[model samples]
Target: MLTLNVVNKELCVGDIRIVGVSSASIFLIGDTEVVSLSSMFDTPPESVIIAPFVPLPTEE
Candidate 1:
């Protein structure tokens, strides 16, 4: 899975007060995904980004 840290410093889009979400998109260039991180409360997140689907790597 993609991580939020790859995009920005925080877990949300705008300020923690306003509305935004932890979102990211995966692009398959070299089998790598470009992720963007942000957040939402009870509702779903906005913005539609698309990319290839790859399984998350398992930890040793």
Candidate 2:
């Protein structure tokens, strides 16, 4: 299993056996064995502005 945390400011992710990572927007897991997983989670608050990277195509 793999643990992961996605939140503002920083992201922390780790596992029980031999996998750990901290303070990153993206986590990379490459061919490893693990036992358990855990994570500190958070929810997005209201009034937070989020912009889409790809804009939708508009009809003429």
| Local error of candidate 2 at residue 41 (angstroms) | 11
- TM-scores for every candidate against the unseen true structure: 0.16, 0.18
Q: Against the hidden true structure, what lDDT does model 1 obtain? A: 0.41
Clashing pairs in 2: none
Task: For residues 11-35, write the lDDT of model 2, one tens digit per residue.
Answer: 4657533233333334444433443
Off by over 4 Å in 1: 1-46
**Lowest-lDDT window of 10 residues in candidate 2?**
16-25
In model 2, how large is the Cα lDDT of residue 60? Answer: 57
